[model samples]
Target: MLRVLIIAQCALLSGVLVAEVSAADPGSRPNVLLIVVDDLNDWVGCLPAHFRANGYETAGAGKIFHHYQNHPSSWDDFWPSKNLQFPPTHVPAKEYQPAFDRKPRPRNWYMDFNWGPLDKVVEETGDWMSMKFVSQKLQEKRDPSADSGQAKPFFLACGIYRPHVPWFVPRKFFDMFPPDRIQLPPSKADDQPVAAGPTQLREVDAR
Candidate 1:
C-alpha cells in the first residue's frame, strides 16, 4: 500500500509539470499588445523595445519585455515628414537637401490641433496637441470594451514623438528636467573619422 501511494504521487507531479510546460511555451500565443512608439529612444522606465528587438526575454526582475523595434525602409519614413506639409517657398535650393533643413520651420503641421486643453499661443502647443491626440486614440483602441462595445483583443501601438528637436514637450515635462540639473551627453570635439565613400562622406557632413 505504501508503494502504491508513492506511484500515485509521482503521477500527480508529472501531470503538474506537463501543465506548467504547456503554459510557458512561446507558440501558445497570448493576447498580443504591440506598442510601437515612433522615434522613441532607450529612455523609458520600461525599455520594452530594446529588449524584444535584441531577443531578451526578461529584465532584472523577471518582467517580460516583448516589444518589437522596427526600422523604416526609407529615411523619409523615419518621421512623419510629409504629414507636416511645408510651404512652397520653404523648399530648399537643392532637390534632395538634408532632412534637417528640409523640415519646415516656425510651425510643424503634422501634429493634430483637436482633443486638448492646450493654449494656441503657447510655444510648445504642437507637442501638447500631439500628445493629447495620441493619448485619446490609445484610450479609444485599448479600452474599446469600456464603452464602444468592441470586446475583441487588440494589438495597440502608442507612438510618441519626443526629445526630437525642436525639443518640444509640455511645461510639466520640461519642468521635470531643470537646465541646471540636466547632465548633457559627452561628445568628442576632435573625433572625426574618415568616410569610406562619397555617400558616407555626405552623410557624415550632413550630421
Candidate 2:
C-alpha cells in the first residue's frame, strides 16, 4: 500500500524527484561552510582582481595548509596577512558621521568600540569554530537518536564583517589599497533623475 502511494506521489512530482535524485552528493553528507560577510563585494583572493594584483600568491594554498594543519583552526589563519591585521576594535575617523545616533548626549555611545552584533550572537550561542556544535544543539533536540558524533560529516560557517561603512578596518587593510592605486567606478551622467513632487524651494526663498 505504501509502495503504491509513493509511486503515485513520484508520478505527480516527477520533476522534483528527478532533481533530488540527480543532485551530486560528495559522499557522507559533505561538510558545508557558509561564510557570510556583511556588505562585502567580491574582493577576496578567489576573485580575478586579487590574482591580477597579487599574482596568485596563495592560489591552491588551502589544500597544502589543510593537509599540514589539524582540523579546526582559527578563522583568521585562512585569510591573507593584511586581513588578519584588523584593529582589535575599530574607531571612526573625525570626519565620519554617525548613522545610528546623530546628536551627542553624554558619551559617544554609537562610536564606542565593540565587535558587531553577529559576533556577539556566535559567542553567546555556541562554539564559533565547531561544525559539530550545530548538529548537537540544533538537530539533536528533535531526534534524540540523531548522530551528534564528530565523524558524522558536518558543516561550518564563519562570518567576518568589515570593509563596510565607518571604513573601520585595520590600518593595514586600508593601507593595502592606497587612494592612488584604488580604481574608482566610472561616474554615470546624471544617473539620479529627480522625481516630480512637492517643491520646498519657494518656501526657502520666502524665509
Off by over 4 Å in 2: 1-95, 98-157, 163-166, 183-185, 192-207
Residue-by-residue lDDT tens digits, candidate 1, 1-207 = 323332332223222222322333324423111121222233331243344344432211100112122322111221123233111111121322343243433223222111112112343343344445445545665564665553433222223333322222344655555769988777564653321122222221232
Candidate 1: residue 34 lDDT (0-100) = 17
RMSD in Å for candidate 2, one decimal? 20.6
Best of the candidates, lDDT: 1
* Model 2 lDDT per residue over 1-207, tens place: 323333332333222231343322323222211121111113232132233344322111121111122122222123222233221332433323333234333333334332122213333321222323334434544565664543232222232323322233334444456669888777555663231111111121111
Most TM-score-accurate candidate:
1
Candidate 2 residue 83 Cα shift, in angstroms, is 27
Per-model TM against the reference: 0.23, 0.22
Poorest stretch of ten by lDDT in candidate 2:
32-41
Residue 128, model 2, lDDT: 28
**What clash count goes with each model?**
0, 0
Judge candidate 2 against the unseen true structure and give its global Cα lDDT, from 0 to 1. Answer: 0.28
Residue 182: error of model 2 in Å? 3.5
